[model samples]
Target: MDLLNNLALGFGVAFTFQNLMYALIGCLFGTLVGVLPGLGPLATIAMLLPITYGLPPVAALIMLAGIYYGAQYGGSTTAILVNLPGESSSVVTVIDGYQMARKGRAGPALAAAGMGSFFAGCVGTLILAAFAAPLTELALEFGPAEYFSLMIVGLIGAVVLASGSLLKALAMIVLGLLLGLVGTDVNSGVARYSFDIPELTDGISFVAIAMGIFGYGEIISNLSQSDENREVFTDKVKGIMPTATDLKRMFPAVLRGTALGSALGILPGGGALLSAFAAYTIEKKTKLKPGEVPFGQGNIRGVAAPEAANNAGAQTSFIPLLTLGIPPNAVMALMVGAMTIHNIQPGPQVMTSNPELFWGLIASMWIGNAMLIILNLPLIGIWIKLLTVPYKWLFPAIVLFCAIGVYSTNNNSFDIWVVALFGLIGYGFIKLGCEPAPLLLGLILGPMMEEYLRRALLISRGDWSVFVTRPISAGLLVVAAILLTIVLLPSVKKKREEAFVED
Candidate 1:
């Protein structure tokens, strides 16, 4: 009954004329970006941040939330239509999705992604609705020690699960932590790593770093690759709707992916991105029936699993951000900015003070996801044409948009320069065979790890045992340690070797 009441209140808010319009607008634009390779939700969102300032907070968030999930749906379009992944999370989808497309079963491959995403997104949203309040309560009891331990686990999870060398991931994380220490120390009214630069006094802008690493870095990497081999959309494209057989195969994968994603979604750090590949890997590991579809040769389950997992993971990620004031990833960090701009405190107190926004946003996920299905399904014919755009033309527009977005952040050219520098750095990372995603994860979480560590020590009079003293804190740290150890083992090393070995 209480849940019903809350949901009812949410409906009242979400159904408002203004909010609904924004949702449609956001979904439309989001799908546009998703269908284009080398462009992503982060780029579009950052560009729109300035524009959204004029709208009411609730309406603004609704639109942004729509864009987030819509991008998830639309991204699958390019991954299936072309070899290019629409987003990092969509990377695994490409392994089998493109194969299905090549087999002239592109309709089913895309339909599975669409249907699975919608189903999983709804389930994920419900999970968030049921669990958010209780989770926030759990977050409230956490002191600096608990937070420090949790952050430790998050950073470790990011590095351990990162696709490349664990050593490189850890090193990147350490560098991020060091960079985070550049501003004025709150403990003492003195600057530390500013080196007498005024902009350094406030520390690096999240916008600058996020845009630098993800937005600009990506452009740099894309430009380094030879476009000569890139495939253009051919006349092979046809009806976008799936056949009856296509729906039959995708259902099981969707259910399996939903379960995996729901569980993984609660974990900190890139759970959305990880769950997709994890589901794909699991599907491959399972038994292969005689005459059953091969793993990478047009398996509908392959298309279904990762899409469902990623969408489910996306929705559940908001649970901690809204309830606990803890941002598990960079995108969530932006939400923190959204909340702050609205004068929301972003802690457990948020539930008490801004129940409307909390419940409204939660409810809006269901609507946003439904809107995506409607936009991406029967309407997919329009999106397939989206893949026809050439990368040579598209990438330059992205570079320009990123440049304009970074410039608009502070109305300063400093961030533009940073983006160019990071673009080169990004290209270098790609050339060196290092996964840029983990570096991004490290860059985003580095400062938070340091802050929590310092605060925990301050509360405990500099006694280091506090992290291991509390039950939750100790458990988390132990998990981190175990994860770190597992990544170092010979077996894991051999597995990663095989991934690149075929190369």
Candidate 2:
């Protein structure tokens, strides 16, 4: 009864005219970015973070959530129509989706992706709704020591699950922690790393770092690529709906994918991209029917499964951020920045303190998923047309927008320089084979961790054993240690590398 009442309240908030409009706008922009190969939701959201300052918190969150999942819907369009994946999570889709386009079965391939995504997205949201309250109750029981230990678990999970070299990821996390210490020390009010620069007193702007690394950095990289490499198959889209046979094949794959995605999405560092890869692997291992296509040769299941998984993963990744104030990925870290900007502290308190924002955001996701379906299907032609725009023109606009967005955050010219500096650093990270996601997680969590550590020590009178003395905190640290041990095993390390290989 309480669940129903909460949902009803959520719907009431989401149904307002202003909230509905923002949701539509977010879905539209999300689809646009998803159709464009190099522009991802992380970068786009970073660029728009400052703009959310003027919006009502509910509308702002609704829009941002829409963009996050709506990208899953649009990414499949590019993967199927062209050989390019608009989002990293869509990389596997290209293998079979492009083949389907070549075989003139693009219609059924697209239909399967769209239908699967919609179903999975809805299921993921339902899980989020059901799980959020209980998780919040659990979170409310945590003290400073428990929170600190939990963050340790989250960070270790990121390192274990992050793709690529463990050493590089560790280095990135350390660097981010050092960067987070740049501002004045809250304990003594003494400037530590400012070096006499007035701008460094407040520490680096999260917006600047996000835009530089994700937005401008990506644009700079995209500019270096030759324009001749892109290939579009816009003319091949003939039919709009899948046949009854195609639907029959797609249903089971979608169900399996949604289940896998919903579960994986809750883990730190395992979101849409990991979910898509895992789902594709599961589908490949499953035996084919008597006359159906093989695994990579335009199999409808291939398209359906990954698309469903990615969408489902994208939706459920919000759980940790909302319930525990821990961001599971780079995108969620940006969301942390967004919530902070609006003066809303994310965590268990948000449920008790701001039920409207919490439930409204959840309810809006259902509306957003529906909006994505309506936007993606009949409007497929528009997205394809958008792809035809030359990169040369697009890159300049992106660069300009990033500059403006960063500057607006502080209305200071120094931020523009800071963004430029970080942009170069971001490119360097790419060149050095480092994943920037862990760095982002560390940056967002560092200050929070420090605060929690201090509080625990103060409460325990500097005993340092309080973390282990508390059952919850001790358990969390044990989990982190176990995860680290498992990831460090030679066999698991090699398998981790193999799992990340897109080919």
Give the poorly placed runs of model 1, Cα more than 4 Å off.
Answer: 42-47, 287-291, 341-345, 493-503
The C-alpha lDDT values of all candidates are: 0.75, 0.86
**TM of each candidate vs. truth:** 0.92, 0.97
lDDT tens per residue, model 2, 104-132: 88877887888899999999999999999
What TM-score does model 1 achieve against the real structure?
0.92
> What's model 1's lDDT at 186?
76
Give the top-scoring candidate (TM-score).
2
**Candidate achieving the largest lDDT:** 2
Error of 1 at 357 (Å): 1.4
Q: Candidate 1 on 288-373: residue-level lDDT in tens?
A: 65656888787888889989998888888888778777666556666766666666766678777778888888888899988888
Q: Over the full model, what C-alpha lDDT does candidate 1 score relative to the true structure?
A: 0.75
Q: What is the lDDT of residue 469 in candidate 2?
A: 90
